[model samples]
Target: MAISRITTVEVTSEHIGVKGEPNISYIYSRYYRAPELIFGATKYTTAIDIWFAGCVLVELLLGQPLFPGESGVDQLVEIIKEKCVEEDYEI
Candidate 1:
Protein backbone atom coordinates (compact mmCIF):
# COMPACT_ATOMS: atom_id res chain seq x y z
CA MET A 1 0.00 0.00 0.00
CA ALA A 2 1.20 3.49 -0.76
CA ILE A 3 1.44 5.86 2.16
CA SER A 4 0.20 9.42 1.90
CA ARG A 5 2.62 12.28 1.30
CA ILE A 6 1.22 13.98 4.35
CA THR A 7 2.88 11.43 6.58
CA THR A 8 6.36 12.34 7.82
CA VAL A 9 9.22 10.60 9.63
CA GLU A 10 8.00 12.21 12.85
CA VAL A 11 4.80 10.14 12.66
CA THR A 12 6.53 6.80 13.23
CA SER A 13 6.00 4.53 16.24
CA GLU A 14 9.48 5.13 17.60
CA HIS A 15 9.80 7.51 20.50
CA ILE A 16 11.13 11.00 19.78
CA GLY A 17 14.56 11.31 21.32
CA VAL A 18 15.27 14.32 23.48
CA LYS A 19 17.55 16.91 21.96
CA GLY A 20 19.73 19.33 23.95
CA GLU A 21 18.46 22.25 21.92
CA PRO A 22 15.82 23.24 19.43
CA ASN A 23 16.18 22.22 15.80
CA ILE A 24 16.89 24.85 13.18
CA SER A 25 14.69 23.09 10.64
CA TYR A 26 10.99 22.40 10.94
CA ILE A 27 8.96 19.91 8.98
CA TYR A 28 5.34 19.58 7.87
CA SER A 29 3.04 22.14 6.30
CA ARG A 30 2.34 25.34 8.20
CA TYR A 31 -1.39 24.72 8.32
CA TYR A 32 -0.99 21.33 10.01
CA ARG A 33 2.05 21.84 12.20
CA ALA A 34 1.76 21.85 15.97
CA PRO A 35 2.40 25.01 18.00
CA GLU A 36 5.54 23.58 19.53
CA LEU A 37 6.98 22.98 16.07
CA ILE A 38 6.20 26.48 14.93
CA PHE A 39 8.03 27.78 18.00
CA GLY A 40 11.15 25.80 17.06
CA ALA A 41 10.74 22.97 19.52
CA THR A 42 12.86 19.97 18.55
CA LYS A 43 12.21 17.56 21.39
CA TYR A 44 8.62 16.54 20.96
CA THR A 45 6.53 13.42 21.44
CA THR A 46 4.29 11.71 18.93
CA ALA A 47 1.39 13.71 20.36
CA ILE A 48 2.14 16.38 17.76
CA ASP A 49 0.38 14.06 15.34
CA ILE A 50 -2.81 14.66 17.26
CA TRP A 51 -2.59 18.34 16.37
CA PHE A 52 -2.05 17.45 12.72
CA ALA A 53 -5.00 15.06 12.86
CA GLY A 54 -7.19 17.77 14.33
CA CYS A 55 -6.29 20.15 11.50
CA VAL A 56 -7.10 17.44 8.96
CA LEU A 57 -10.41 16.76 10.63
CA VAL A 58 -11.34 20.43 10.59
CA GLU A 59 -10.49 20.69 6.90
CA LEU A 60 -12.47 17.56 6.13
CA LEU A 61 -15.51 18.92 7.90
CA LEU A 62 -15.27 22.49 6.57
CA GLY A 63 -14.10 21.68 3.02
CA GLN A 64 -11.20 24.13 3.50
CA PRO A 65 -8.15 24.54 5.70
CA LEU A 66 -8.95 26.01 9.09
CA PHE A 67 -5.56 27.69 9.17
CA PRO A 68 -4.64 28.61 5.64
CA GLY A 69 -1.76 30.84 6.75
CA GLU A 70 0.48 32.54 4.20
CA SER A 71 3.64 32.05 6.27
CA GLY A 72 4.89 30.38 9.44
CA VAL A 73 4.24 33.41 11.59
CA ASP A 74 0.90 33.91 9.88
CA GLN A 75 0.09 30.27 10.58
CA LEU A 76 0.77 30.80 14.27
CA VAL A 77 -1.42 33.88 14.26
CA GLU A 78 -4.26 31.99 12.59
CA ILE A 79 -4.00 29.17 15.11
CA ILE A 80 -4.00 31.59 18.01
CA LYS A 81 -6.96 33.46 16.62
CA GLU A 82 -9.02 30.32 16.20
CA LYS A 83 -8.07 29.02 19.62
CA CYS A 84 -8.81 32.31 21.33
CA VAL A 85 -12.26 32.35 19.77
CA GLU A 86 -12.89 28.74 20.68
CA GLU A 87 -11.90 29.26 24.32
CA ASP A 88 -13.50 32.67 24.56
CA TYR A 89 -10.14 34.23 25.35
CA GLU A 90 -9.48 37.83 24.46
CA ILE A 91 -7.07 38.32 21.60
Candidate 2:
Protein backbone atom coordinates (compact mmCIF):
# COMPACT_ATOMS: atom_id res chain seq x y z
CA MET A 1 0.00 0.00 0.00
CA ALA A 2 0.97 3.73 -0.42
CA ILE A 3 0.09 7.08 1.09
CA SER A 4 0.50 10.78 0.24
CA ARG A 5 1.98 13.43 2.54
CA ILE A 6 1.22 11.30 5.60
CA THR A 7 -1.23 13.38 7.60
CA THR A 8 -0.26 11.51 10.75
CA VAL A 9 1.43 8.33 11.94
CA GLU A 10 1.26 6.19 15.06
CA VAL A 11 4.71 5.05 16.15
CA THR A 12 4.17 4.04 19.74
CA SER A 13 3.62 0.46 18.59
CA GLU A 14 6.35 0.41 15.92
CA HIS A 15 9.33 0.65 18.26
CA ILE A 16 10.44 -1.65 21.11
CA GLY A 17 8.00 -4.46 22.09
CA VAL A 18 8.82 -7.92 20.75
CA LYS A 19 11.26 -6.62 18.14
CA GLY A 20 9.12 -6.87 14.98
CA GLU A 21 6.47 -9.43 14.17
CA PRO A 22 3.92 -7.24 12.45
CA ASN A 23 2.57 -3.72 12.50
CA ILE A 24 -0.62 -1.98 11.43
CA SER A 25 -0.84 1.66 10.36
CA TYR A 26 -3.88 3.88 10.07
CA ILE A 27 -3.35 6.52 7.39
CA TYR A 28 -5.51 9.60 6.85
CA SER A 29 -6.03 11.06 3.43
CA ARG A 30 -5.09 14.69 2.94
CA TYR A 31 -6.11 17.51 0.55
CA TYR A 32 -3.83 16.18 -2.21
CA ARG A 33 -4.15 12.44 -1.96
CA ALA A 34 -5.48 9.52 -4.07
CA PRO A 35 -8.72 10.70 -5.72
CA GLU A 36 -7.75 14.35 -5.68
CA LEU A 37 -4.59 13.29 -7.39
CA ILE A 38 -6.50 11.76 -10.26
CA PHE A 39 -9.53 14.10 -10.59
CA GLY A 40 -9.66 16.79 -7.91
CA ALA A 41 -8.25 20.31 -8.16
CA THR A 42 -4.84 18.98 -7.12
CA LYS A 43 -5.19 16.19 -9.65
CA TYR A 44 -2.12 17.48 -11.36
CA THR A 45 -0.14 17.02 -8.12
CA THR A 46 2.96 15.07 -9.10
CA ALA A 47 3.45 13.43 -5.70
CA ILE A 48 0.09 11.68 -6.24
CA ASP A 49 1.10 9.01 -8.74
CA ILE A 50 4.83 9.46 -8.49
CA TRP A 51 4.91 7.56 -5.20
CA PHE A 52 3.18 4.48 -6.64
CA ALA A 53 5.35 4.35 -9.72
CA GLY A 54 8.44 4.77 -7.53
CA CYS A 55 7.30 1.89 -5.32
CA VAL A 56 6.74 -0.55 -8.19
CA LEU A 57 10.10 0.33 -9.62
CA VAL A 58 11.74 -0.48 -6.29
CA GLU A 59 9.90 -3.79 -6.08
CA LEU A 60 11.17 -4.68 -9.55
CA LEU A 61 14.79 -3.79 -8.84
CA LEU A 62 15.18 -4.68 -5.16
CA GLY A 63 12.20 -7.02 -4.81
CA GLN A 64 10.72 -5.01 -1.97
CA PRO A 65 9.36 -1.66 -0.80
CA LEU A 66 11.95 1.04 -1.32
CA PHE A 67 11.96 2.95 1.95
CA PRO A 68 10.30 1.65 5.10
CA GLY A 69 11.02 5.06 6.64
CA GLU A 70 10.18 5.52 10.28
CA SER A 71 8.07 8.52 9.29
CA GLY A 72 6.22 9.77 6.26
CA VAL A 73 8.52 12.68 5.55
CA ASP A 74 11.55 10.43 5.82
CA GLN A 75 9.97 7.86 3.54
CA LEU A 76 9.14 10.48 0.97
CA VAL A 77 12.69 11.73 1.13
CA GLU A 78 14.22 8.28 0.90
CA ILE A 79 13.75 7.52 -2.77
CA ILE A 80 15.24 4.63 -4.76
CA LYS A 81 18.67 6.05 -5.36
CA GLU A 82 20.51 2.73 -5.07
CA LYS A 83 22.15 1.32 -1.92
CA CYS A 84 24.74 -0.87 -3.58
CA VAL A 85 28.37 0.17 -3.74
CA GLU A 86 29.43 2.66 -6.40
CA GLU A 87 31.51 0.02 -8.20
CA ASP A 88 28.55 -2.38 -8.27
CA TYR A 89 26.41 0.24 -9.98
CA GLU A 90 28.67 0.48 -12.99
CA ILE A 91 28.65 -2.58 -15.24
Candidate 3:
Protein backbone atom coordinates (compact mmCIF):
# COMPACT_ATOMS: atom_id res chain seq x y z
CA MET A 1 0.00 0.00 0.00
CA ALA A 2 1.10 3.64 -0.59
CA ILE A 3 0.85 4.14 3.14
CA SER A 4 4.44 3.01 3.13
CA ARG A 5 5.30 6.71 2.82
CA ILE A 6 4.58 6.98 6.52
CA THR A 7 7.55 6.55 8.84
CA THR A 8 6.15 3.28 10.15
CA VAL A 9 3.66 0.96 8.51
CA GLU A 10 3.08 -2.29 10.33
CA VAL A 11 0.84 -4.98 8.96
CA THR A 12 0.29 -8.53 10.23
CA SER A 13 -2.86 -9.44 8.27
CA GLU A 14 -4.79 -8.66 11.43
CA HIS A 15 -4.17 -4.93 11.71
CA ILE A 16 -2.90 -1.94 9.75
CA GLY A 17 -1.06 0.59 11.86
CA VAL A 18 -0.92 3.30 9.23
CA LYS A 19 -3.79 4.42 7.06
CA GLY A 20 -2.70 7.25 4.77
CA GLU A 21 -1.86 9.83 7.39
CA PRO A 22 0.12 13.02 6.91
CA ASN A 23 3.62 11.98 5.96
CA ILE A 24 5.80 14.66 4.33
CA SER A 25 8.59 12.26 3.57
CA TYR A 26 10.16 12.52 0.17
CA ILE A 27 10.84 8.79 0.05
CA TYR A 28 8.01 7.98 -2.30
CA SER A 29 8.78 8.23 -6.02
CA ARG A 30 7.67 11.65 -7.22
CA TYR A 31 6.36 10.29 -10.48
CA TYR A 32 3.61 8.22 -8.87
CA ARG A 33 2.59 10.54 -6.01
CA ALA A 34 -0.89 11.99 -6.10
CA PRO A 35 -1.51 15.74 -6.57
CA GLU A 36 -2.55 16.09 -2.93
CA LEU A 37 0.84 14.85 -1.77
CA ILE A 38 2.57 17.23 -4.14
CA PHE A 39 0.62 20.11 -2.58
CA GLY A 40 1.65 19.13 0.93
CA ALA A 41 -1.62 17.72 2.13
CA THR A 42 -1.62 16.49 5.74
CA LYS A 43 -4.57 14.13 5.40
CA TYR A 44 -5.02 11.75 2.49
CA THR A 45 -6.64 8.48 1.56
CA THR A 46 -5.75 5.19 -0.13
CA ALA A 47 -6.95 6.70 -3.36
CA ILE A 48 -3.37 7.86 -3.79
CA ASP A 49 -2.48 4.25 -4.46
CA ILE A 50 -4.93 4.21 -7.34
CA TRP A 51 -3.05 7.16 -8.81
CA PHE A 52 0.24 5.36 -8.32
CA ALA A 53 -1.10 2.22 -9.95
CA GLY A 54 -2.34 4.19 -12.92
CA CYS A 55 1.06 5.82 -13.37
CA VAL A 56 2.70 2.40 -13.22
CA LEU A 57 0.33 1.01 -15.82
CA VAL A 58 1.02 3.91 -18.13
CA GLU A 59 4.76 3.52 -17.71
CA LEU A 60 4.51 -0.18 -18.50
CA LEU A 61 2.44 0.49 -21.59
CA LEU A 62 4.67 3.29 -22.93
CA GLY A 63 8.03 1.93 -21.78
CA GLN A 64 8.66 5.30 -20.08
CA PRO A 65 7.19 7.39 -17.32
CA LEU A 66 4.17 9.41 -18.35
CA PHE A 67 5.29 12.25 -16.07
CA PRO A 68 9.05 12.09 -15.84
CA GLY A 69 9.60 15.30 -13.88
CA GLU A 70 12.98 15.87 -12.30
CA SER A 71 11.66 17.06 -8.92
CA GLY A 72 8.52 17.54 -6.85
CA VAL A 73 7.66 20.94 -8.30
CA ASP A 74 8.51 19.75 -11.76
CA GLN A 75 6.36 16.70 -11.23
CA LEU A 76 3.39 18.93 -10.35
CA VAL A 77 4.04 21.05 -13.41
CA GLU A 78 4.10 17.97 -15.63
CA ILE A 79 0.78 16.82 -14.19
CA ILE A 80 -0.77 20.25 -14.67
CA LYS A 81 0.39 20.39 -18.27
CA GLU A 82 -1.18 17.04 -18.97
CA LYS A 83 -4.43 18.09 -17.35
CA CYS A 84 -4.49 21.33 -19.29
CA VAL A 85 -4.07 19.52 -22.56
CA GLU A 86 -6.61 16.91 -21.58
CA GLU A 87 -9.28 19.49 -20.75
CA ASP A 88 -8.36 21.78 -23.66
CA TYR A 89 -7.50 24.58 -21.23
CA GLU A 90 -5.46 27.49 -22.52
CA ILE A 91 -2.05 27.84 -21.07
TM-score of each: 0.65, 0.31, 0.68
Residue-wise C-alpha lDDT for candidate 2, range 1-91, written one tens digit per residue: 5543322323353432231322122222221123322232322334444544555555556544555555544443343234546575642
Worst 10 residues of 1 by lDDT: 1-10
TM accuracy, model 1:
0.65
- What would the per-residue lDDT of candidate 1 be over residues 6-91, giving only the tens digit for each residue? 43335433333344533322555678888888887776556576887888877767767899999888988898897776557766
lDDT of 2 at 15: 33
Instruction: For model 2, state the Cα shift of residue 66 in Å.
Output: 1.5
> Whose lDDT is greatest here?
1
- 56-90, model 3: which lDDT tens digit per residue? 77776766778989988899889988878755776
- Arrange candidates by TM-score, highest first: which order? 3, 1, 2
- Name the candidate, 1 or 3, with the larger TM-score value: 3
Report the CA-based lDDT of candidate 3 relative to the real structure. 0.68
Candidate 1 vs candidate 2: the TM-score winner is 1
Instruction: State the weakest 10-residue window (summed lDDT) of model 3.
Output: 1-10
Flag regions of model 2 displaced more than 4 Å: 1-47, 80-91
**CA-only RMSD, every prediction:** 5.8, 15.0, 7.8
| lDDT of the candidates, in the order given | 0.69, 0.38, 0.68
